[model samples]
Target chain A: MTETTIAAPERSRRANLLRTQEGVLFVVLVAIIIGLSLLSDRFLTVNNLLNQTRLFTETALLALPMTLIIISGGIDLSVGSMLAWSAVMLGFSWQLVGLPLPLAVLICLLTGLLGGVINGLLIAYVRVPPLIATLATLAIYRGFSFGISQARSARGFPEEFAFWGQGQVGPFPTQFVILVVLIVIAHLVLSRTGFGRWVYAIGNNEVAARYSGIPVERVKFTLYAASGLMAGLAAFIFTSRVTTTRADAATGLELDVIAAVVLGGTSIFGGSGSIIGTVLGLLIITLLRNGLLLTGVKGDATFMVIGLVLILAVLINNLVRRR
Target chain B: MATQAGRLTQAHRQRGLFAQQEAVIAAAILVMTFVVSLANPDFFSATNLLDIAVNTAYIAVAAAGMTMVIVSGNIDISVGSMLGVCATIAGELARNGTPIPIAFLAAVAAGGLIGAINGALVAYARIPAIVVTLGMLSILRGGLILVTQGRWIESLPEEFFFSQRSTLGVPNPIWVMIAVTILVGLFMKYHRFGRAIYAVGGNAEAARLAGIDPRRVYMFVFVMNGLLVGLAAVLYASRFTAIQSNAGQGFELAVISGAVVGGVSILGGTGTVIGALLGSLLISLIGTASIFLKVSPFWLQAVQGGLILLTVLVDVVRRRRRA
Candidate 1:
């Protein structure tokens, strides 16, 4: 039997930075940045760097929770749909129902939370596999969004809403600032909290975790619910950036989110990953997307490059892990 | 009975469970058809029935392959994109004056090659199936757009219409679907390689000790799946006037959902193509029923999601009762 039958084991107690996965990712990220900068003069500029961060803020937010979900040995394929649903609700509540923008935002967040709760209930309480549960929700949420919006786009949000995505705070994009705060909080929670340990425990072995009284179901439920809430928050930011709420917004976003998390060295089988690693992965992906665009690579070609990166990254990681 | 059912999975008695599940889906389909036809007698029209079967035939064919892949304990989210690529290749070749059968063969061959790459990476390189396919999804999707420049391939040759033609008084698409299903279904039930797929999925190490190479099984299933996707692509493509850039969008969900709903466990090593075809038929029925029931078509996804949830819940309950 290969190790795939079980969760990845604990990290080695002996630390070696250069030998670590994150260290390798950091090196790769630097190399790509240098390569891209040489390819395009615009790539090295501070303005471009700051601007690029805005486009990736939503991915970063979703990646944080996605990392947690994947680390816990579960997946949520519906995050993109949840984001779309929340965005639809935001616009529907604001424009269609004539609610205050702030209230609409709150409702958006609630919709996300509710969506997560549904997943949590199915997975945690009902013991439905996360993949199937989320897949179903993916369709359900997307359908609901389309049904309510009639596949129409909602545009023209108030300036305050726009500020969350595009407005600057002293030189940093507002979304970038928000990402930093959440990133640090996520890091602390993942690295320092008892709940965090429980997450790893459950992923490492759910049966043992249950016997150890780790409240396995609760942890899973909370993780999924939190994933939904974060998706809502990301939807809010995404809507603010685009200044439009459409049911189709964030279509296929789960790929970027999951790609970054996996590239960060998160194990698909569960346990053994880092937020620091995720941030690095996020930076690498964002850089490639922006860098490729700056180098005159059309939007579609960038997908190919990212796809190659995704496959090669894991391929390399697995070969090294085997050694 | 409870004890026997309890040991169903461990003992690998897939037929009993699959038959039970198939019956459930068949009953649901009957109820759904009855309800819809009662609401609108036109739903029972021969033309509409034929139309439904024609449309569902492609999904069913693809799902037959999906059931095998899932049974082998892996997934390919890239199937939809692969189909798009196959269809593009077929159309491009046909437009270039290649013989229609040869063009279709080339498309299927291209699909097989892509599947081989995916399989090699998963089996040899040890990348997670989901991650690899996720990457492939991006590559193919982006690559297709880059090649086609967001344009649909139209004015296909008259002889290229695969779905419209018939043999022995049955529509060609339906014949293809049924033939593929029967061949694969028989292969799965009686072939040594097919049994190897289950053995590998159930316990790779044990299968290895028993002289079965898990790697070969992995490769075979992926390539086989790709071929089916290619066949499905051409079938679906020929029915429409143009092969759109967004061809096969959201298709993976329908195929995978059908497999799971048909009682093929995502956990691997258990399930049947017959059940998967039934599951796909059930889903397509819901989609068709929506049109006749006069509800928003978008609600189709919600129903699909709900049905998946309900099916999974039932499986869980059944497992619990046996315990």
Candidate 2:
């Protein structure tokens, strides 16, 4: 209930360092890295590590906003679908409809914005619950993705288009670099601004926050649109990397992003979580996946581990709180 | 005395609201029936009706359980994965020469076991139901693929396709859906445990103070959900000659949306199986209506999503008017 938890000052921050989820997860993440390094030589390599980061850049993009969304006591289950829809539209417009690639990308981002705004309008203005509103969009967008593309993938984009997806920026994947930059921005926005405080306030108690003169509807509306915009950018990165845009792109991705955020110790009920925690959570998941693949585990099998980790993370959080 | 009478009337009107939801859904079903019959005159043929019923059967059954979970103030995003797991179990067992009935029962039992895990975590570990189920969703989905390696079960005894046959001129699948809906619907209405679920969802602390064990209620709803999922799995799995490991992917969305569209509030505490079943029927009709109308089947998902949003919008508007 203290302001310190939301925007920790240096002194109080240090005091709660050991008790915070970020601290525990940092220790756990280090232990995992070391343990995986021991288990597989390939696991500790810079190439593999960056490769892992590159793999999740798109979803990590989503986790960034998801932290805010959950902290605001709302959820957007349509992000994966948003990614697919945007990706599909990006491809469809450019390849099928003969639009310029740059314009196509703009359309993609616009589609994402439009979808998010609709979700926000439904939830904030119409008072539809977040879960139900997003669920509807999840289907509608994915369907449009498939239908617009006529169920076929769009491929063979201009050569320059691949740079954002497959290009490297001094040993860092381009997408990861973009992700890191966004992470910092999201971090500042979430922890160091009145807007961020409003998100936490809304999460803790929407009615109370509203009575206290916060613009609850505007904040929620903006967050959802932000989510959609992020999903749109992710869609671009994902399609560029894979060099293909299919309706099924990023299928089940919402699960992975959610798993990472929740595993980072964000309360699903909202109001408490940090960008650092989400980043570490994302790192742990990506590392475990890469390590498992190195250790002869199939990529998909890591989903089982992630699922267990997601649950165990919350379990540990509950235990810590009780203590 | 005046306030007492007013309070009684208010309660009566509240009950009437739920009845209104059911009536609205039934009306939708009637309207859809007319549309289908008008568009495809042969749609009412016994054969065509049975085919449609078969499709609606599993969805309605699953949504009925989903209705219970939502009414109890929780959700199970793992429904699709659980259904996949259960169906795979049934298929794998039958392929291993197990009795058809035993395989079906084992699938159902496995569902209950998984549900119990979800319940236990949500109840005892103090994990949010969404997180617990999301974890289960990942675990089951990943584990199923890991175990099956995306293989399909092709060979099966004739008796394994129990749902494909007609009984007393009605396909067995219709019978299964109807029986499950009837039983679940009645239990939810008249049973003490059912009413307790409503109390717990409406307010857990109030229910606990009023002598209801909310934990037990949570467990019961989840477990019951699992059992219904089992039945749904067996029925769904029986329809295909080749049981793909990925069966039921994205199915939870359909089922949950069906329940919500049928009138179950995502925030919980109210909805009925009859409404849910009718909602499922309505969805099935829309899907078929597209094909019958010569619209691309791809538009079905968008229609479903749009319908959910439309229904929720109506619900929200009506509730606002009442307030």
Candidate 3:
């Protein structure tokens, strides 16, 4: 029975491709962009596009490692909290230790990686479930962020740091360019590297991957560490954009990143997904948010619309998959 | 025949032992309450006890529904958002001179509608429950913010407030909670529909083979959960006298924790209304004790995390022993 059940899907591989999520999501993205542009004059403006792209950069950065982690059959619910912790650490290191800007940034990223390593060790070795493990780390990291920052905002970073948040290059926002470069690198690694294949294989079946000689624990550990590093990088950009670091910064961004991944058609149960789809998902979310804002919908209302879109996207994804 | 009788008796004895385990936890809670009261004489006062009950009522009622949902192999992280949405809608209706009961019904039905959408996606469309619900959480939260424009609604009708006032010696919220508990408890034990829920959770393929439609069970549980969330919203609004856009933020965690602590497995398959009620009481006790003991509010999240870890760890150990 098991053989038959597994074999049935393999026999229809070509049909599965035609029914893949990316094609459907791409069509939806194009339709939404065109529709929103038709409805609002500002939707297609270059300035508005740049602003929208900038807004998505933080989540997009975090989503890269999140994509890999999810593909590797784990989750990091603490990334948003980790971002706050990293930002706080970066601020404290610069102000108290007088570390140079580059060193401070590296310290922040390393802090994130270490936090991720702790989570990975607990999950992969200690045998804690990913959800519970990350949930605990989420609280711990958030608490640590508050303790170190004394629940206060940290300011006075060097002026040059603001360039990452506000600077422009060739008619595009710097953040947008950064996100695009990161996306390209991430896409290549996932598509071109054996490490990427191993991630998918692990997600698909840990036992099978182990039997095939994949270093399951090491791959999982690295994916988690990578996720934390990306979150740290996101924190850097976010702090720069705001020109301040608060212990409470990015309080709920993990939800947004996860929403984008799921919106992009990544199976939450793991195994199959794509970077391109995630990029498109990010665009869709950003545009929807910007469009609602331009329509004079307040932030709260905009959140509701995003929630609706998320549900709608998943419903459509499921419908497609079933067919 | 003798061997068969011995095996049957052993199974009965094991079931009795499981029941005793639940009783032991309940006794521990009683003892802890007594100890806490002794330490803080104010904790034993009528007002403080009533306050604890009122606070636990909403979460307890919501957790009951959530327990059933989780036991049936699904989860609803959107309860918090649903509560916010329901409260906002109720607040709006009350302000518009709608009778209190009508507004309350509208609030609950609104939650039911959201749940139905979740049900359709998860059951009919075959999407994974976690992804669909997680997306719903964001969408609902966003919707609440959008509808309220990040503003608090403080103009609920007088009758709406009055309904939460004490009836005899018991607060109205407590009575409502008791009513809900009895109904859910009876349903879980006696109703064919209820038994089918357990069957589906215990083994979906087997349930399917037994001519049960697991999808229907999924849809029913989600809808029921939504209604309960709406009920919670009414209580929340009355108690606070103000409904913020972010009302019930992170509520899913509280509900999930309560359900799990009450012996509901995160993996799903088993739970009890009594267990969930006790779990809610335990959490409320901790929260109230923290305040009475003058523990820093900063430690609340950490303590909650610790309690959750402890509960799940014990549950795992117990299950292993049983196996």
Candidate 4:
């Protein structure tokens, strides 16, 4: 039965870059970039490249932890909600409560941590499935943000705070620099640490990992907390960029994050993926959005393109794997 | 008597479990109604109660299909987007002078086609159900918006309002909801194909060995889910004066919450249509209770989220105790 499953002929792994999922993604990413550059004269400019990176910084930050979580065979659907909630808190603490900028930022981070802790407790201790637990929290957190803000928008942050998102260092956005640093740290942690191995073990088989003394619950708690922290960080960056905080901020963002992770050749069922692949997936998605927009795909058509990319990316990956 | 209970068949035990769960939800609804009526005598108004029922009928119909999908060990979050697409197709066709039945059929057919695509990808391509449906969700929503240019289809024909009217003193939507629920419930309880759905969900390898085609089951359940979404789309049109591009946003989450809160195990193989209906009722009751208690609508989501967590927590405890 297992042998019957693979209908495609096997290929030598060493012979072709196209044989590997990541390699295939890399090739596709390059092709898209080349194709876009050919189609649009503005696409090849350094300014546009930097702008694209800046635009994607929040999603890039969110994707790092999401890649880890999905690799660990769990999902957190509440990250977008968490980001919204934390952004609201950030604005409220600064503008409403008259707190110092640093303190308000701390509160935003802590709010995200608290939200993650609740999710962790529900899943790790209470034994609820991550999907259901996070879905509940998604609504809960969104509702809290809306309730507190009274469905209003908060804007006009101090210029110094906005600098975090809008400032440039040698032609690169500060947000871009921050995201790069975080990505390096995440890649190291995923590839060079025992925790990373344990994550793979847990995703592959939770019962076996627990029996192997892997401290599964603690790892889960930390991963979820880290995801929330990233969301808080993203909240800061996103709010700084928009210079506004609203209840509906980052709505549908979870989709982009998940699409990137899955398109990165990560198994949605968990246990195998790479940060590099995720970055590549992110680049592909960002390029698709940028390229489509540059090519004049209006409003919802851009979404259709992204959606098609998501499905076709995975479908193509699966087809490649069968060989 | 205790021995007699112990000696009951497996089917009887399953029935007993279903009854116990339904009883809990029913009892909760009763208490909620009682508390709300005490807070505001207007809660007992027939018109308000019937309004809740009408609002719930749409969700309940979708939940019925969701229950089957979940019980078959798959999920279709694309139902919300599917509803949007179906609504537009039906609405536009009706506005273009197509007969109601043909328009309805076209909408259902469109839904079925999308579901088939989703099912084929998951079952044949072997992509994960969540990922497939998530991608489809984006694709359908984007496609709908593109086709309609983000415009709300207004001024639908008078015949299109048929579902809004009363038939034998009951709203057509409520009647449709009841008929669908009963038919699905009976099908789940006594039909061989229905039993196959449970069997495949319970253990696909075992079901395959016992001569059931799990792929066919997956495809069947998804198509059925889409058909229900198509039907619910018509009811959705009747409720609103115009159908916007974002008509059914976040709808899948609500339906899934109802199924989860209704005792349908996300792990599959143990759910009933009656439980799904009751779960919808419980959710509707919560909404009504919030209104009577004068809670802000913003807090309603938090309350519903809390209830979902509460129900899942109860289920977890019950399962652990059983073990």
Spell out the clash pairs found in candidate 3.
A300-B145, A300-B146, A301-B145, A301-B146, A303-B142, A304-B142, A304-B143, A307-B139
Q: For residue A196, what is the lDDT in candidate 4?
A: 87
Candidates 2 and 3: which is better by lDDT? Answer: 2
Scored by CA lDDT, what does every candidate get?
A: 0.88, 0.87, 0.81, 0.86
Candidate 2 segments whose C-alpha is farther than 4 A from its true place: A1-19, B1-19
Candidate 3 lDDT by residue in tens digits, B22-141 = 474597688877998989888888888888888899999999899889878888878888888898898889889998899989999998898898888889877778777877787777
User: In candidate 1, what are the lDDT values of residues A1-323, reduced to their tens digit?
Assistant: 46534423323341242248888999999999899999999899999999989999998999998898999999999999999999999999999999999999999999999999999999999998899889889888998989899888888887778899889999999999999999999989987898988988888898999999999999999999999999999989999999999988888888889999998988888977889889999999899988988878788778888899988988887877788
Candidate 1: list runs displaced more than 4 Å: A1-19, B1-19
lDDT of 3 by residue, A233-305 (tens): 8888888888888888888788889888878867688887778878877888888888877767776567666
For candidate 4, the TM-score is: 0.94
- Worst lDDT 10-window in candidate 1 chain A: A9-18
TM-score of chain A of 3: 0.92
DockQ of each: 0.74, 0.83, 0.44, 0.70
Cα displacement (angstroms), candidate 4, residue A321, comes to 1.6
Kindly list the per-residue Cα lDDT of model 4 for residues A235-272, writing each as its tens digit: 98898899999998988798889999999987889888
Give the Å shift of residue A79 in candidate 2.
Answer: 0.5
Worst 10 residues of 2 chain A by lDDT: A10-19
- lDDT value, residue B128 of candidate 1: 88
What's the candidate order when arranged by decreasing TM-score? 2, 1, 4, 3
Candidate 2's residue-wise lDDT over A1-323, tens digit each? 58656745743753374247888999999999999999998889878888887788998999999999999999999999999999999998899899999999999898888888888888888888898899999999988887888789999887888888899899888988998999999999987899998998999899999999999999999999999998899999998899999998888888888888888877789877888889999999988888888999876778899899889988988997899
Better of 2 and 4 by lDDT: 2
Ranking by lDDT: 1, 2, 4, 3
- Expressed as tens digits, the lDDT of each residue in B1-323 for candidate 1 is 12223556644554555337878899889888888899999999888887788888999999988888898889989999999999999999998899999999998899899999999988988888999999999999889988998899988899999878878877888888788889999999889888788777776777888899889999999999998999999898888878998798889988999899998889887788999999988888888889888888766777778888889888877767645
- Among residues 3 or more apart in sequence or in different chains, the pairs in candidate 1 whose N, CA or C atoms overlap within 3 Å are none
